[model samples]
Target: MAWALGANSNSPPFAPAIGANAISTMRAAFLIGIFAAAGALTQGGAISETVGADLIGGVTITPLAASTGLLVAASFMIFGVYSGYPVPAAFATTGALVGVGLSLGGDPAFGTYQRIGTFWLLVPPMSGGLAYVTATLLRREEVPETVGVPLLAAVVGAILANIRLGVIPHPERAQGSLAEAASFAVGRPLVAGVDVVAILATVVVAAVGFRYIRAKTQVSAEQGIRTFLLILGSVVAFSSGGSQVGLATGPLENLYSVELGLPSIILLGIGALGILAGAWMGAPRLLQATSREYAQLGARRSIAALVPGFIIAQVAIALGIPISFNNIIISGVIGGGLAAGSAGVSRRKIGVTLAFWVITLVMSIAIGFGLYRLLSTVLGIQ
Candidate 1:
């Protein structure tokens, strides 16, 4: 999402705060590493789990194959991020995984493919339309601040409350609602009378307590809207992490599951580390590529991009589909650009990026399939 990029973006004011020397560069690297690690733990882990479990149903990945796939995909992602190009990691990795898996005796899950393709195709137009509408509404003079802000807050609260949660790769084992989790922790059944009582108690406390405090502050409606947007952006970032890392680590599913002698958690940890490293060492360039190349963005524009990106990424994660962060962000950028008007963005740059996306997917699939076939023949694999 745009805010994810914006948050990591070195603002103009911060540019002069650090020098561009070896020591400074080293320090930057250090910070990048830390940020990347955090990114990996969240995004990488989610991505890996999706790739491993959903790519081919009813068959566990082999160690050699998984490692081969992961190494290849991750290398390309790092290359793109470092070279200041937005490599659609999800496109490349997912295509590669399908190529490799199909060549290795896996059947194509046509339904899954269709679902993923639908989301991928839908995002650009949907995001653009939503951004246009949101921008228009915000520009309106008659929309009341009190009503508008609370409505936004309710929307954000609904999204946060419904996000899937449980152990990775096991949707059925979900922790259920936040209220359910709390009730379960206290030895009460989620559907029992006790649970209902506890839920009411918590709701009363949160609503009354928050309302009392908010009334005391008497904050302006604009302030409330800003707060809601901020909260929404944060949730979106967390979801983005869950989705983007899959491209980084999905290829390694076999190694983590077999050779590494690990479960989903352990594999997720390893993938997370790789993502963290990538984010720290390689994330900034891609961030720059997006921020500078897409459109000139203020805070509101940035938030618009991020919200949709986050939503799409989380959806991909849930479906066990691989996706490109670059594409997702671009969809948002295009949406924001449309809202701003036709002349506000670079048509040439958009064309180039689109070309690259097409080429990347085609090339990655061809190479992956070819490599899998060659390897299988050389190894006498069945």
Candidate 2:
């Protein structure tokens, strides 16, 4: 989680110098390259596969179109990162793809649009509600660190265990339980991952419960709650990376893989680098704008804003839906603030942002359609 936050927070300060040279600039560039590369290795393959194979109606993107989309999206991100408010990379890129596809006279892929819309709509409320419930629960007298943190950790651990070890019907990959993984390393009878998972969960719960019972100090309780929030933040960030990277590159997948004969992996590598650049150059200003211009968000409030953004972003990535991180973050901030109190949320800001969203989508679509027609006409070919 810390790593994820660091990635998000540190990026805006380093990206510009990717084109420069200095000990610090070179180091920043190198780290950016490394993370982008690592992200490609970690997330690129699955994302590229889905984008290339899943996002169309038997369509093969033209090389001209793919390169055009990639260049267009990349240019937009750089512009946002350096000058304009950081528009969501997901929105810009996805919009470009849709634009290009429509330009080619392809019917709107409603199924894909529907899925993306649903996730975008669902993420903010769900994450905010969860964060609220978690926050409220920690405020109660009956929770303490040993009990709360460990219990939450155990739950997280169990999910990780199950997701990793459980056998899927299709993939045939061995999904070992966390407990099983731990036991296997020491040559123990493989604990049924589920049973071991349950036991671990119980122990964590008991520890937290006892600590709450023994609460002799207020500071201890506060420490425990912060730890829990930190853990939640971490979980949200890592999951987000997996889901959000696709927005940075999914549109060009068919162009790179099918049209240009580049490996999907290479396409992904390019996309990840683009995202890393977007984050480093663009995100901070947007973050500042949201943190201050949209609403005053202290750490507690910011957590409310960020948790939902992360959840929505991840869902977008998981399903191969392109969306703006800023859009998600801002929307989540609005919802979260509304949940806290309607007074603090600014109506004008919301109106302007929403209006921008509509304009961005419409303009991108129009431009794409117009450009396609112009190209086809000039070439005297379809």
lDDT of all predictions: 0.55, 0.49
Return the TM-score for each candidate structure: 0.74, 0.68
lDDT of 1 at 277: 49
Q: Worst 10-residue stretch by lDDT in candidate 1?
A: 11-20
Per-residue accuracy of model 2 over 82-183 as CA lDDT, tens digit each = 443544555555566677776765666778777766765665567556545543443456875445444544444444333331122212332343445454
- Candidate 2's C-alpha runs over 4 A off are 1-40, 75-79, 82-84, 132-237, 255-263, 308-316, 376-382
Steric overlap count per candidate? 12, 10
